[model samples]
Target: MAKTFERGISSIPGYKELTENMSIQDLPLPSELIIPLRQHIGAPNRRLVSVGERVKAGQIIGDSDAAISAPVHTGLSGVVREIGSRMTQTGQMEDCVVIEVDPEQEKVKYTADDVSHLTKEEIVQRIKAAGIVGMGGAGFPTHIKITPQTKIEYLVLNGCECEPYLTCDHRLMLEYADEMIAGARILSRVLDNAKVIFGIEVNKQDAIDLLKEKLKNEERMEVVPLDVKYPQGAEKQLIYATTGRSVPPGKLPAEVAVVVQNVATAKAVADAVIYRKPLTERIVTLTGDAAVQPGNYRVFVGTTLAHLINSTGGLKPDVGKIIMGGPMTGWAQKSLEAPIVKACGGVIALTREQLAAAQEYYACVRCGKCVDHCPMALYPNYIGMYAELGKYKQAQEWGALDCFECGICAYVCPSRRPLIEFIRRSKRA
Candidate 1:
């Protein structure tokens, strides 16, 4: 039987048919790239190159001495044109390195290494040097995540692309299964040959079956089919569903002796460990009702939303909004000028008719729907109410910080309250 976390919306539409079957396509290099200096959640990176300096593809352009930060590399050979602040997919102004891509560009060369003789520290160093972060949206540095301080028992490979209108991870699992499996093995080897479990949602039956067949003869590896549920791919939720282990609030999966890595992140690990390739590009699902050519494209990091849309024959006339990631948790873009960062996985262009029309929200009716469906088991109603009333302490007391902002509370609210916005404010406070 497929496993699942408690109390999450299981009936939500996936809308994955728009791009799930589409094979990964390579997006042509754009004329310019706006690489953000800080794409991860840790310490900010300092610019390493100045304007007018020429750099090659895969060359590091920004880095930080902080142990928690990941390096930023250019995806195309180009001349540094500007280093200034620009609105990123996060809807916040961040320092970006703008590069004018050279017309005559050569593919970045990567040297392959024999993994049989490489030490665990060497493997992690390669991943760090490759600038790989969690491609599943958290954007945590992968090297830091794989090298946990505690002894890890399970290396869970998250293949559950649960978000509606997103299929990047799904396509990767279907098309790059070999690389992903190899990466999972490499990760396991680093963690002292920890048991590897591929946690895939049942919606992706083909992926589960393929991985299972591939790993039938492999040792210490198995694929567990999971129930189709929102936030099923979250690290904590996935760990619980797969291993029957609950990660306490204000703690990480490491404390529970488990580490989850996204399927795409695992593929990048394989690329870094075997080919010494840096993380410069990722597969992004450009899909939705308003998209003219919806499919999965392997887009270079720092490519703008406008470029992606224009590449796909542009959006339909009735396009109402463009979101950077998935509909549930992605940021709605105010401008197409915002560039893609490392963690971006999907670009959804929805028609006005497809979008929920904005309306005035009333006070919480104290209904238990939000609490009933909340996967984190947090009281979103009280948190939103207190946060709306300018009581941050009260909101915090109601478990505002414990909320992962999955948006289930807002989706289930009968009063149409923006619980996520309120929770964000509370968390900020």
Candidate 2:
């Protein structure tokens, strides 16, 4: 039988349409920014710029010889104030470069050589130099994902921002489809002319229709309408939904000969290759009841959450919880000062009432809804029970790390058990 989420799997309420056509408020460029050395999943970049050293935009400040690592750049032209560990979004201390921006912003020029004219190597080098990592919350480098070592097949563009209350990608799809496809072409060029599969959920029919109408002539790039579901944006699930391939647990999609890139990530690649702009800004969804004006904004990396809130008229005085990214996998944050890193897909401002009541968290009723909705097909109740018991090793054996935390299990459970949270806590323990 095919897997699907529960009926009435509630969406993020008040998911109002955020039009990207309007002029978004520019966040006050911070006097200084905290640029972490290890934004990607790999080893931290080795810092090269010392304290008091001046670096320009697109200037590579940290680099690594490690293949899995992506280089880091100074988002703003600035003088390095310090290089040391600081508290990051994930709430762990990591090494970061603190830079004080020059009062007069340094100008970085883009020669405007079209991507079609650039060689694959030239594009790849430009991507690396631009410090272009995934901006759609994955943080993977564009260069690494663009180069497919295997025979090219389908190019899965993840536009299904399935996470609740977040429509950053949605707004982008509705407004920036042309630029998005231009970016997709760069990836396709690198992939040796693979057919494109732009995946968007049924809920995002506007986005689907928008891209479909635009790509009337591009036969190779077809829009694939997917079942509106949680975790649909996940690479493995997306591949299966779009092409019927099971990416085995503990293996990358590439291991099964597939390359998946988020739509936002694809756009970033286009900017790096065509505009020669470093990955410095991203469109982040700022929504939920607590925000004075809930909308999406294109913000530069390293801008503080408080800065965005203030610019958006500040969070309502009684804002209960601040979440970074989509509600499903987002980190519940207590700090307002956390800077918007590259991987952040959205910033959520939730009022007290919007926050889920603890009273709703009931004991497991043995309903097995968790098991039914889990995309990984693990025994969520069993895994969740073991996790609650503090059996970290057993939880790992039960595939705790594999949980994408899409919340389908919790969404369907009659008991309102926090199955994902249980597994997450166990994995951390």
Using lDDT, give the best candidate's number. Answer: 1
lDDT agreement of model 2 with the native: 0.78
Q: List the residue pairs that clash in candidate 1.
A: none
Kindly give the stretch of ten consecutive residues in candidate 1 with the minimal lDDT sum.
Answer: 354-363
In angstroms, the error of model 1 at 93 is: 0.7
Model 2, 1-429: lDDT tens digits are 223333324344425454323334456667777788888877788998899998887777788998877877777888899888877777777888888888788567766665567887897888877777877678887788777677768888988777777777887787778778998988888888888999888777778888988898998998988766677777788888787787877887877677898898888777778888778778888887788877778886767787788877887888888889877777878687677888897888777876656336777888876786687787778778888888888888888888777777876777878877898898788
Model 1, span 333-372: residue lDDT tens: 9989999888999999999987665456888888899999
The number of the candidate with the highest TM-score is 1
- Name the runs in model 2 displaced over 4 angstroms: 1-14, 18-25
Error of 2 at 280 (Å): 1.2
Model 1 CA deviation exceeding 4 Å by range: 356-358
TM-score of candidate 2 versus the correct structure, residues matched by position: 0.91
Instruction: List all candidate RMSDs to the true structure.
Output: 1.1, 2.8
